[model samples]
Target: MPAPPSAAASTTNSTATLDDDEDELNDLRVAIAQLISLPQAGSEVKEKGRAALHGTVEDMRAFLDTGYRLAQAQDDRVALAQLHSKPDTSPELKTAVRAILRTSDPEEMRWFLEVGQYEVDQ
Candidate 1:
């Protein structure tokens, strides 16, 4: 077999791994920041983003993987309910909201809240 790695080589490998981990963490931080900055991001999304920023790497990954979508969906539902309750909301918008609710798809609801609602209003 080949000779074992020297102490210097082992240290270099460890340092490289650390650098990679730091880069990943930095990327995750930037992603969370971007999510928090979104105009369409609701309170739940913002709150979760903030939490993930202050949490561990796993927390950030969890937020990006699942938490963000779930929080966005919750916020979307709340927004739809608020819009439905509003007296001045247009009939077309209300109808669109009803149709979105019927679908029960979080992604569809999120899309309606983000873009489809404006299209319907216009």
Candidate 2:
């Protein structure tokens, strides 16, 4: 029987996969942006560009959804660890765990990556 993956191996794989996803997402965004920057073109070309943009947007949504799931899992793991370490999981403890989970904003991540930015409440 095959052995389960080691923690180090799992982390490495996750990071590599996330990195590849980021690269693909960035490439798609760049392609769509380039299409937008071009001078006015024929209806056929414009239509194709719009289609490509829509598809890229869908791809991005997929990537973000996957990342969000992973983030939730990570949060759950941390919360579990906290529970294991302590006898009481109080309301304050639950609130702290929730705060940790909620601290990672997808919009903030995009802004940090310089993908795009809009005004965000501080």
Best by TM-score: 1
Report the lDDT tens digits of candidate 2 across residue range 72-98.
344444434454356665655555445
TM-score of 1: 0.87
Model 1: how far is 121 from its true place, Å? Answer: 5.4
User: Which sections of candidate 2 miss by over 4 Å?
Assistant: 1-5, 56-122
Candidate 1 has an lDDT of: 0.91
Record all residue pairs in model 1 with backbone atoms less than 3 Å apart, i.e. clashing: none
Q: After superposing candidate 1 on the true structure, give the runs of residues whose Cα lies further than 4 Å from its correct spot.
A: 119-122
In model 2, the worst 10-residue window by lDDT is 113-122
lDDT on C-alpha atoms for all candidate structures: 0.91, 0.50
- Tell me model 2's lDDT, rounded to 2 decimals: 0.50
Number of colliding residue pairs in model 1:
0
